[model samples]
Target: MSSPTPSTLRVGRRYRAKRLNGPYDAIVIGSGIGGLTAAACLSKMGKKVVVFEQHYTAGGFTHSYDRNGYEWDVGVHYIGDMGADHTMAKRLFDHVTDGELKWAPMDANYDRLFIGDRQIDLMAGPKAFVDSLKNDFPDEHQAIDSYMGYLNQVAKALPGVTLAKVLPNLLAGPFRRLANRKAPAFLNRPTQEVLEGLTGNQELIAALTGQWGDNGLVPTESSFIIHSLIARHYLYGGYYPVGGASEMAKTIIPVIQQSGGEVFTYADVKEILVEKGRAVGVLMADGETVRAPAVISNAGVYNTFGPLLADNAPHKAFYQMKLGNVQRSMASVCLYIGIQDTAENLQLPKTNFWIYPGTDHANQVDNFLKAPDEHDIPLTYISFPSAKDPSFAARYPGRATVEIVAPGPFEWYADWADKPWGKRGDDYEAKKEAYSQRLLEKLYEKMPQLRGKVDYYELSTPLSTDYFCRYSTGEIYGLDHNPERFEQDWLKPKTRIPGLYLTGQDVMTCGVVGAMVGGLLTTVAISGLKGLPLAKKMFVG
Candidate 1:
C-alpha cells in the first residue's frame, strides 16, 4: 500500500467527551442521510438534537473521500425526482438543506443496460422512455404502456403506505388494510412474475428490470413494490448534487446547529442506555454517557438490535425472532478509478451503465454465488461521477473519476474481518487485486479507446464497508427488498420501547431519498402534533 494520503475532506466537528453539550432533546446515532434529516427537521421544530457518526465524516453512504489526489463518493451515484421543485424529494431536500444545496441534471439517456450482447437505453421523461422501449420492442408497446400505468398506480398508493408507518397503532392497522385493498394485487409479488404476466417477451422483461442492482436484488427475488418505486423515481431522469454528495451533510448540519444541535464524527456509540425498559441516552465508546429525552437509531436494524441494545431487554427476544425472518442485503465491491484528464477531455458521458451476463438475472446470481470463482460476474454497474456533477472541474482541475460496483458476499472476505483496513496481509491484497482486474476488464470492454490511460485505481471490498460503515456483514442496502421483508409491521419508525425510534434504509426502503424519507417519518413519529404542520407542507400541501 502507498503512504497514507490524508483526507482534508472532513465535514462534522471531531467528537470529544468534553465537547458534548448536555440536556439535548434527542440523540441520533449515525449521520447518514436519514439521521441528518431527522436531526435537521427536529431542529426546525425547536428541539436540540445531537447526531453521532462512527466514521471520520458525516453523510454516511453519501460521504466523499479525497485520496491519491482524487475524490470519490461512497454510495451516491445518481438520484431521481430532483429535476422538478414540486417533487417530494426536492421539497424534503430544500427543507432540510435550507435551499442551499443544488442539483445538476444528467443526460436525457440516463441509463444504458447491456444484457449479454444486446443494449437498451432508458431515456428521461415518460414519452421518451416509452418511445425508447417501443422503438426497441415494437411488438410490446402495449406492455410498455401498461408498465408505466402500473408505476403511476404505485405513485398514487405510496403516500398512504408511507403515512401508515408513522401513524398511531389503532389508525395504522386499518390504514394498512385499506392500502392493501386499494393497491394492485401484484404489489408484493416478484418483479419477474408481474412483468412476465404483462408481456411474454423475455427480452422486454430483462430490459425493464435491468436496474435490479439498484435495489441489490434480482427480478425474481425482489418485490414489485420496490421495483415500481425505483422505476418511477428515475422516470424523470437522474440528478446529482451540484457540489457532490458530501454537500448533503454540509448543508444540513447548519440546520442542526441552529437549534443548539451538533453532528459529531468519530463518536463511537457503545450501547443505548435503557432504564426501566426505556432508552434514555447512549453510552459512548470513550466511557462517557450523554443523556437525551429521545434516542433515534439510524445505524440499521441488525446493528440497533444486535449490538446497541441490551440482551436482557423485554423486546430483545421478539426483535431477534423478527431478525430471523429477513436476511441482509447484498454486499458489494467498488473499484474507484482516477484519470489525469478532465471529464470533457475523456469524453465521459453523464450516464450510468448496468452490465449483465445474461437476461436471466436470478439464475446468473445463483450460479455465481454457488461458485463465485468459477462463474461469471452477475452484474456490474459503472458510474462516471466527474461527468455527472457540474462542479467537479472546479474542485479538482484536470481530473476525472469513475466507480464500478459489483456483488461481493461477506464470506469472501470473512478471514480478513479482524485485520485493520489498508494493513491486510498479502493474501487479502491478492484477492482484491484479482477482483479489481476483472472489474477493470469489464470497463475496458465497453470503452476500449483508453485501454492504458488509467492513472490510479483501488478496489474496496466488503471488509472495507464493515470497517468504515460498521455494517457487520458489509450489507450495503440494509435489509433485503424481498416480499417478506416489507411485510414486517415492526419495521416502522416507532419502536415498542418507550423513547427509542428507528430510521434509515432499514425502516423504509433503500436509497438516498428513501433513507431521508425514513428520517422525516421518524421526526413525525416522535413529534406527533408538533410535526403535523411540517408534514402538511411536505405531504399534503
Candidate 2:
C-alpha cells in the first residue's frame, strides 16, 4: 500500500487574523452548501458577506478529498432533479454558482436495491419508474400509482411549509394552519404508515422504501414528508457534478468574491458574541473578534445552540430546552477504495447499489444495532464516483474510485472519541480494519472483478465525520427526520435572538438541496422585502 499524501483538492483561501477584510455586512459561521448559498445570494444583493469554515477545504459534505493518487467525495454521491433547468433545485444551484456548475446524468436505472436474494431497479422518469415496478409486481399496480400520488401531494404542500419557515411569527401560525388544511392527511405521518395504507404487500413496501438510508431513517420512524421529498427529488434520475463534488465550492466561491465577500478555510469560530441581547459578531479561536451586524450559523442546531452560543445569551435557555425535542441522525462508516485501472477498464457502473439483508428494513436495522456481528449487515451502499463524473478520468488518468457506506453507530467508537484523528491507536485501527474488510467483501460479492484490483482502501468511522465535519456525534444528516421532528416550528431561518439566524439541514430537511433551501430561506428572512425579487427568481422561476 502507498503512504498517505496531502490532498490537492483544497478550494478556499486560508483564514488568518491578518487576512480579515472587515466591515462585513453579515458573518456566516460555516461554508456548507447552506452557508455558501446564502453568501452568494447576499453577494448578488450587494452585501459584503464573510464565511468561515473550520475545515481545510470548503463545501462541507460536498467537498472531495484526495490521497495516494485517488480522490473520493465524502458525502455527495448522486443528486436528482437536475436534468431540467426549471427545477427549484437546479435553479437554486445555478443561482448560487452563477450557472457555472454543471451536472452529468446517471443511467436511467439510477438506484438498484437488493433485498436478500431479490433485486429491484428504480428507473428515472415518473412513467418509467412506475412501469418498472409494475413489471416486477404486476398485481399491485394501484399501490404503485397511489405511492406516486403521495409523492406529488407532498411536493404540492412543500412550498407552503417552506413559506411558513420564512414568514413572520405572527403570520406563520395562520399560514401553517391553512397549509395543513389543504395538505393530504398523510403528509407528516410515519412513512411506513402511509405506505401500508396504500399496500399490504411487504415486498412492495420494502422496494418503495429501499432508499430510506438517503434520509438516515427507516420507513417506520421517518416522516412521510422527508421520505416523499427524497423519493420525488430523485424521480427524474441522479446527476453527478460535472467536475466533481468540489466543483460546488469552486464555482460558488467566485460569486461570493465577486462582491468583496470571501469564504475562508481553517477559520475556527470559538463563540458567537452576544451583547445588549443581540448577536454582534463572533470570537475566533485565535482570540480575534470579527464583528458584523448579522450572525448566521450553518453549524447545525446542536453546535449553534450548545457550543457556539454563550450560556447567558438571550433565548439560549429556550433553544437548549427545544433541543430535547429532536434526536441526532444516524452516523456511518465509509470505506473509500482506489483502483489503478480506469473506471471504463474496470467496468464500473454509474448506478448506485443499495444492498439489504431482507425486506423488513426497520426490524433489520433494529437487530443490527442490537448485535451488529450476529445479524447480516442491514445496508451497504456503493457508489462509483469515477464513473459518474465525466471529468474524473482526465483529472486522474488510469484511476477509479469506489465508496461503500454502512451504519457505524457512534457508541461503537465512543471509547476512542478523545483521540486525535489519524493517530487513534492500534486498537482503534484494528476495529476499523475489521469493518473495512467486511465492507470490501460486500463490494467484491457484487462485483467480483474488482476483488484483487483494489489498489488501496481506507475505512473512516464516525470519528472521521466528527473530526472533519464537526458533527459531534458524527451524525451525517443533522437531525433525525422522524414524525415528531416536523412539528417543531422553531426550526426555521430566523431565531428568537435579534440578528441571529440558522441555516443548513437542521433548519429544513437533509440533503444538499434541502440545505440549499435552508440557505435560500435565510437570505429571504434576512433581506425581508429587498429579497422578494431573489426569492421570486429561485422559487417562482
Q: In terms of TM-score, which candidate is strongest?
A: 2
| Tens-place lDDT digits, model 1, residues 328-415 | 9999999999998899988899999999988889889999999988989999999999999998888888888999999999999999
Among all windows of 10 consecutive residues in model 1, the one with the lowest summed lDDT is: 1-10
Q: Candidate 2: worst 10 consecutive residues by lDDT? A: 1-10
lDDT for 6 in candidate 1 is 44
What's the residue-level lDDT of 116 in candidate 1?
88
| Model 1 quality (TM-score) | 0.98
RMSD of each: 1.7, 1.4
* lDDT of each residue in 6-61, candidate 2, tens digit only: 55689899998999988999999999999999999999999999999999999999
- The Cα local distance difference test for each model comes to 0.92, 0.94
**Considering every candidate listed, which one attains the maximal lDDT?**
2
